[model samples]
Target: MKIYRIANLAILSLVLSIAFATAACAADNTVPGWDPAVLRDASTIKVMTTEPDAGEHWSNLWVVVIDGQPYVRLGDRSYVRIQRNTTKPYVKLKVADQEFDKVKVEEMPDMKDKVAAAMADKYWMDVLIRHESHPMVARLVPEAAPPETPSH
Candidate 1:
């Protein structure tokens, strides 16, 4: 009887642990550090991309935070097509596994100059401070309508 009880408890613990791990993985699959509402409501955002000119470095762009908000950081020298096209109201955003539509672009004044400088110093890489002059501002506008039928 003692062995049986101990075995039962161990199995219970293992099951609970597995359940917790599965939940964590599911959460991780979504954008990190974002509420679903913010993702749906945000009009502008930064996008992290692979810099074609940097030879294996990441680039950041001002983009629409469509669908859902995910964590994003843009470098000073990112692409401009997405920003320019937003004037015609053509934009999209990919956050995690979801895609956002109707993103707008806008410029934001420099608020992270000190932080950027510090990071550059630590990494020993040069980062441009005149990011605003580089035309790096953009906003993302998501559709307001929810799906008529949500998938179960």
Candidate 2:
């Protein structure tokens, strides 16, 4: 009876340690806040990871930071996870080699034109000249939220 009790205590301690270790691993997976400093002066970037069916996601995409916000323009035919999701998507942004995984994404299809006009002025000679002439813009909104930790 004494040996059985000691074994049970050891097992309980092992389980608790496992649980704590798992939690620590999860915490390491996501960033806590929007660190704008990282994106302060980045050039061409691949902002998102492609969905499973999409082929070769990283095309040289330009990023425009306007009024303290970041925006990207994607075409109507673009195969993006954001396009498929009815509600705003959960986004992870990898900018300047740092990953920010706790962002809430919003779609701004209607404001595409307005955003383009704004970008034309801000980016000037260095803007996406081809798209600017056509102006097919898609905007993404990211918010700081509960970190979306990946689960095993």
Candidate 3:
């Protein structure tokens, strides 16, 4: 009975260690093109979207980070850009001095509430804007780096 109790305590310790390790790993996994420290604190970022006819359209807008991923909310005018992104997910993001090219933009309707909450936390204006604008939430996924060629 003493041995069984010790084994159970060890198992519990192992499980707790794994849980803490996973949480730490997630905290370290910062979104690309964004400095982890600034992602949640920066006021705005420059986003360039490809327009079907008008070429690249650039706009500086508020960015929110949720679960280590970067998201942006678009109003009626910018919402059209999100539709355009459905076909061409490629986009450019400028966060401070860092610029990320060819990043994929995916609309995340399911994360609207979460993104809005993050936005409200970051910006006081969002408290009022959230009520006035029916915004669409979109996630920015970094483009995968190209494979390296083997030198002969």
Candidate whose lDDT is highest? 3
Better of 1 and 3 by TM-score: 3
How would you encode candidate 3's per-residue C-alpha lDDT over 45-70 as one tens digit per residue?
A: 88787777877788877888886678
lDDT of 3: 0.78
What C-alpha lDDT do the candidate models reach, one value each?
Answer: 0.43, 0.56, 0.78
Distance from true position, residue 87, model 3, in Å? 6.9
- Give per-residue CA lDDT, model 1, range 1-152, as digits (tens): 99999999999999999999999887563323335554434444333333335323223332223234322234435544433342344345554445554333344434244334433443333355334343333334344434569679
In candidate 2, which residue ranges exceed 4 Å CA deviation? Answer: 1-33, 37-40, 54-56, 76-81, 84-88, 122-139, 143-152
State each candidate's clash count. 14, 0, 0
lDDT of 2 by residue, 1-152 (tens): 99999999999999999999999897552445454444546665554544656633434455676555667665443335455533336555666776654344445667666667655655665454635243345444455556569999
> Model 1 — TM-score against the truth?
0.33
TM of each candidate vs. truth: 0.33, 0.50, 0.70
Between 2 and 3, whose lDDT is larger? Answer: 3
